[model samples]
Target: MKTFTKKLTFYMGKGHIVRDITADIQAVVNESKIKEGQVTVQAGRSVCIISTIEYEPGCLSDLEKALEKIAPRNDYYEHSKRWNDENGHAHIRSTIVGPSQTFVIMNGKLCLEPWQQIIFGDYCPNEHPEWEVFVCVIGE
Candidate 1:
């Protein structure tokens, strides 16, 4: 078995930003040179998340709206009450959705659905200077 890993960082300006990282993940798969395996994408912070979603205008808008109702950024979270951090909502949002995702690598390509795209979503809009994502690829 062979294993490969890589790390990436991004500085999100905040306010519900969704970025497609499919290419980046694919790049890692290529770099790993793994013919068949699995890759895991994870965020470094608890306030952010990694997941698959349709990278379309309408679906993207709906996704944001769903997050708003699920874990409204403006709502008061006990985490914020303790830390006095407005990003408490970010914690809740990430917990509800999760912060990491796994994808299969086939023939050195990501086996993703047509509409599915990997992305890092920021539910909390803070002046966070940077966000990091870690990739782990392992298999034959």
Candidate 2:
């Protein structure tokens, strides 16, 4: 078995953002020469997540809307008092969604549907100035 690890740094760009990581991850798998296994995308933060979904304008809008519904920003969050962060809902939302996603890599390519894309789902966390991402590959 072979294993590889890579960390990427990024700057948040306001609002909800879904950045594609398919190509970057593919490069990692290629470097490891892993013909079959899995790639996990992990967000190194308390308020970020990963998901596989279609990337489109309306869909992006819907995603932002959905997060709002799942964890409304205006809602009262006791955590805010503890940390004094207005984005307590963001942390809750990311917790519920998750911080990492694993994708199966087959025949040296990501095994994903046609419309499915690896997206770094950034809610309020995207508004921050700094962010970190983890990419780990383990395969033959």
Candidate 3:
């Protein structure tokens, strides 16, 4: 078995930013020549999440709304008091969503539904000068 890794960096603005990264990941799998195995994509920060979803504006907006309700930004968080950071909700949101996602690679391609796509979400309340994403592909 062999493992291949790639990193992507993005500068994110304040608020939520969801970007579809399916094609990028597929390129990594292709570069690895991993005909069959798995690809794990991970976020490099506590305030970010990696997941798969229907990459549509409506769905993305709904997700952001749901997250806002689940972890309201205005709510008081003990973590905020400790760290004196305003992004306590960002941490909670990331925890609920997760920091990584794995997809099966078949026939040297990502096996995903027609509408399903991998997404990298930056949930930080403030702008992130640099957001790093890691993609790891393992197979033969």
Candidate 4:
């Protein structure tokens, strides 16, 4: 099996920002030249999440609302008190959403539904000067 690994960097603004990264991951998979295998996309931080979603305004809004209901930023978090930081909710959201997603690579392309796109979410309450995403493609 062959493997290709790459790190994608982004300057992220304050909390609750989501970006579509399907094309970026697909580019990595294409560069790997792996006709059949798996591509794993991972966030480098605990406060970030990697998952699949429909890249659209309505869907994005819905996701935001849902996450808010699940983990309200205003809620009390012991982690915040311990760290003297206000990003406890961010960690919770990241844990729930997960930090990585693996997709099949078929014919040198990422196998995903037309509407399903990989997304990276920054949940930190503060701005991140640089956020890193790691992509690994492994296959024959």
User: Which regions of candidate 1 deviate over 4 angstroms?
Assistant: none
Best by TM-score: 4
**What's every prediction's RMSD, in angstroms?**
1.0, 1.6, 1.0, 0.7
Q: How accurate locally is residue 22 in candidate 3, as Cα lDDT from 0 to 100?
A: 90
Better lDDT candidate (1, 3) = 3
In candidate 3, clashing pairs total 0
How many angstroms is residue 132 displaced in model 2 relative to the true structure, after the best TM-score fit? Answer: 0.9
lDDT of 4: 0.93
lDDT of 3 by residue, 21-103 (tens): 89989988999988999999999999999998999989998999999999998999998999887889999999999999999
- TM-score (all chains, Cα) for each model: 0.96, 0.91, 0.95, 0.98
lDDT of 1 by residue, 1-140 (tens): 99999998987886578899999999999999998989999998898889998899998899888888888878878888888878887888888889999999989999999999999987666677788999999987
> What is each predicted model's overall lDDT from 0 to 1?
0.88, 0.81, 0.91, 0.93
Task: Give the lowest summed-lDDT range of ten residues in model 1.
Answer: 121-130
Query: By TM-score, how accurate is candidate 2?
Result: 0.91
